[model samples]
Target: MARGLVGFREQAENQAKFFVSRGIPIYASVLTTALEMIAAGEGHVPSVLEEAWKDREFSSPYERALLLCASMRFEALRDSSHPLAEKIGDDADGQGRVTREELDRAIDFGRTLDSLVRRFVQTNEVSRSITWQLAATCFEGDGPIVVIDLGTSAGATLVGDRIAQNWQAADGSPIVLGEEKRARKRYGLDRRPVDLADSDQEGWLRACIWPGQRDRVLRFRRAVEEVKKAKAAGELVVSKMGAEDMVAFVRQIANENPGARILVAETAFIDYLPPDIRAPFEKDLGDFISAHPGRAVWSGLEDALAPVTEGGGKRFPAEIRLRRASRMHVVARCEWHPSVVAIDHAELAKARTPH
Candidate 1:
């Protein structure tokens, strides 16, 4: 349902605050002003922005707003001549606050990029590969594993073992966990799979990230190289399947390999799910977990699902966890992406306890 002008402003503000907290002030300034202009009757705001709020496919006005924000970044990145490019440059000014004129330019730029907002936010965050790998280390000795990813996007995460995890402690020292290669087979499902080989598809993922964050872009690039290796290995083919179908496919895999452990994972993918679909998928997957008991594990590297406090009594914005049925053990707290994770030895030790 579309939030009217009033409701749109509120949600946009909330999302803007989140952007600021996440250290993307350029986005924070642009998006808040863009939606504010739409809410009030100022400037020639794009009608498609309003249309998306009404469209059921887009669950939130905040999401649509960011899509528009990212589209501007994409446009700028593609063509330096674009009006929005000046604000999204890789220099210090790009990371700073947006001026009123710059914000206006972004609103004007929205008309050209309005249609892009309808597309889902398909980040397929690359650093989350490390998070999944960290969680898998907990059960490394259990048995051979068949890794399945729901909403796998480009299937970059299926190659977690291939990702270089330069892990860090809360005190900022390196903590090596050695190499991992336990997964015998890996599979992934995405509603619309992105072919990393395709430049256009790859460009979109690059644009989804805030410009000037070179570390994140570098991590994504590295992961893309790893995903190529996985693709060459097998049908780590990111099948075009919805969440429910992905669940069913996972079950089929589980039945086929009774001897192997089922490691089902979601990497920042839960927030993409609308409430109605997420509910049913949870019920179906929960049923699978309940039936399998010790055999099946559902791990999630999610911001919304992270515990409030980790093993060390420190709080984090996001966490990696291992879940079986209703029980959960948070394996680590991520201070930042692509690197800097605080593995909680206390909770990791608890993973050994039988449920």
Candidate 2:
């Protein structure tokens, strides 16, 4: 848990072993347990946890993180001395139970974990293979593009990808991807407004850094500045809306902008939807494609794992999925072409800045 949540640490190996004993996938044991420790420490239990820990079922790392995240909301409410009052407090307005401040912090932590963990996993050849497989499915095209990011927290990945991407041009010529000259139009959407008010975001971002990786922090900071400049100039726009609203908005945008290529990347989203809710969520994706036809793209990680399992290997379903869904793809690529965009050093350098 500590290793997964906190990044490379001495005890990660032991903790990972502990997780293996429980039949919880090592990835999950580290992440979910770490999240639980953090969430419970902050004073809450997620509504989905009990379900998450249920008997044998596939559980995704992101779902575990989300469950931990959603539960963090109850900390203030659960802190009350009286049970009834606490229950009442739990029922208190969302403001009292989960403040915007807390949510922002939690989400930031979750995203940091997402980024760091991905980096950690990528070090392994197998993980790299998996990433290539997924990426191949995403970056397929001869494309000079306009990028649209969904669930783009603080526009980190979108800007980072743009800054870091190394891909071929539509003419099949190798383009370094970020010359900082391409007039790439970028947009982002999410249900909650991200309060990236400098200091807070930077603090949260810095906390996620691994010791020798301070260099990455510097790069992340530069990328963040680029994004900030873009937003300030109105070249980038991030909207507050739920998944459904986002789909509708994107549909409209895609329809109106035929010549502009769209790329939708949902970093650590898509596992929050309950199993029952996945149909509609997927339907929304399909609908967006049907509406925009070949012009739009959508990418995300889907947690195929069940949330919990009993003591011996009996897996059971939870109210939500736990997988980390972080991928990018174009609608047209799904049908005719599929490829992965390699991250160039320049883009990675720019992306390593402090949030």
Candidate 3:
């Protein structure tokens, strides 16, 4: 997987070039960190890289690997002969190191790209939806409510939502809540085990923040911190299962919770499944929601715009047509069943606007 070193570096340099091009004033320390992470095979690279750079004062190769690896699938970097191709092993002395070959092997740009894109879409939805939903409705009742998040990535989206609903602070700033209400239940389901180990993933998350949007970053960071605390306290739970399994789990949760309202958010996740897989998944999901009857919001690349037509006669709507150049679109759907509930279409429209 090590073939793309030159190209990866080119992209990195391109990124660096972009910063230079726009005069963004990236810290040199950060640049060095980015380089090392990109070059090194293994070590406490990701975590150390993250901890050392928390001040936003440094970025490293490690950080770059985290960012670029999580988001891009550039084929040139997919050589498996590199040092990073396999998990690095330790010597008798307990020191960790990886050869350049390993680094070369470990780089798979496409998977990383998918991960990064998924992350971006989900976080954008949370930033836009969670705070308002919590303030307006989620916490309105007296008793606690259960939350089941399908296709949860690292459970970050669910955790972020709970924090927003339960925490005293407003969406951005850390405003303390006088009320003591808290969500009673939380569950997350996904096919792949979310990478709790990747601090650079967290850091890449940090990088996405607009300078003026400090509060949004803080909100997410705080939510993540809570999950860490819960895990430390032995209260965190996440189910390693895919869409089908998750739907089943939700059914059980619904039966157990009994009238407990549900919050289901699949941020940019459902589109990955082909129609055949998606049909059963969607049907199961629709059934579960219909049975439980609560509020849910789904945001992703929409087939509405690019409908897969039969007979090969048509394409998606004019607006939904995939951008020939970027090939990315964001769409979200929010529903509240059982007679009536509120949906802010305008807010969804604003959130779905392409980044």
Candidate 4:
């Protein structure tokens, strides 16, 4: 419990700091107060989080707690007339502190504590730019590209590959991919996939967005809309399955499409797996890639601290890796949400060594 509380505090404070730096003062204030309340064991917050604190299901207690807070705020903001909707704003004086009564009200607003725990972070669009970059570098093959998205909540990331998006590199150059190189085939797997066409699911996706990031909210909504349109036209498919199952399915697809280049991508999903499962998953991935030498690539944009025995013990805030034909490359070390990316050419040159 003590470790959980300490971890939760650190995560919350980090989230608060990020929001503050991003100009969302309202979120920063709410998260800061939430952290304080959790530390003091005040209000119903501690009781609400008690089970999660004890459970080892969460890889990051901070993320679990912070997402709960965001969920509450999302629920509160859904009703335009809600007190919090008017209080949270970009204006300096408009960022009001979250009151105990308001917190209680949010708790009573229908979503159970356990339900919030089960909710996955669906911010896959954040990694779209980086995924494109990886595809360009790792998948320099002739055949059509097939992207299999693991832990694909709402399938926004899968859909993102099909649509046109503007992204800037670290040096502010525009990043682009030709239509031919884009994933002609897209498949997504999730324990529970959110249907973008459903109003309730759409609302939940909206709720998942941070309170004040209008650009992100808009971007997410647009992605959802595009996916819905694509699905209706019979251009995409997202299946309900776990990560391990998704890998098996990818192998089957590879068998069917002999020469098609496969790119298995996961962003922010691998961190949720337990240590026991995570290691096996990586091994399974390596074995699968080894089975089909030059036809496949496994790309990941995950926490830099993920336990990798190789790579010389250097730590980064976040790391992007592309593995193809027994060779692994540490492509970039970037911000958690890599809206801007810095490519390490020197590291890229050295990454060709067999892992």
Provide TM-scores for the models. Answer: 0.82, 0.45, 0.46, 0.78
Score candidate 4 by TM-score against the native: 0.78
Least well predicted 10-residue stretch by lDDT in candidate 2? 120-129
Give me the overall lDDT of model 4: 0.65
Candidates sorted by TM-score, best first: 1, 4, 3, 2
Model 1 lDDT, residue 2, Cα? 52
lDDT for each candidate structure:
0.70, 0.40, 0.42, 0.65
Model 2, runs deviating above 4 Å: 1-145, 161-183, 209-212, 301-355
- Arrange candidates by lDDT, descending: 1, 4, 3, 2
Given candidate 4, what's the lDDT at residue 351? 41
Expressed as tens digits, the lDDT of each residue in 155-242 for candidate 2 is: 6554554344333322345533333223266777766544355654443443332222323445556666766777888877877777
**How large an RMSD does model 2 have?**
15.5
Candidate 4 residues 1-355, lDDT tens each? 3433446667777877776765667767777776667767778766676664555355654566556655665556566545465654221232446776666555555564644656654555634546544544555546687788788877777665445555555667866644434566777788888887887677767766666656566668778777787677665688899766766788898888887877788877788887887887888888888876666778777777653332433234677877766677777776555555656676655543333
| Span of ten consecutive residues with least summed lDDT in model 4 | 87-96
Instruction: For residues 167-256, write the lDDT of model 3, one tens digit per residue.
Output: 222122343323223445566677764554467555544444322234555566776676666556544566788776777777676677
lDDT (C-alpha) at residue 267 in model 3: 44
Model 1 error, position 69 (Å)? 0.9
- For model 3 the local lDDT of residue 350 reads 42
Clashes of each: 0, 34, 39, 0
lDDT of 4 at 112: 41
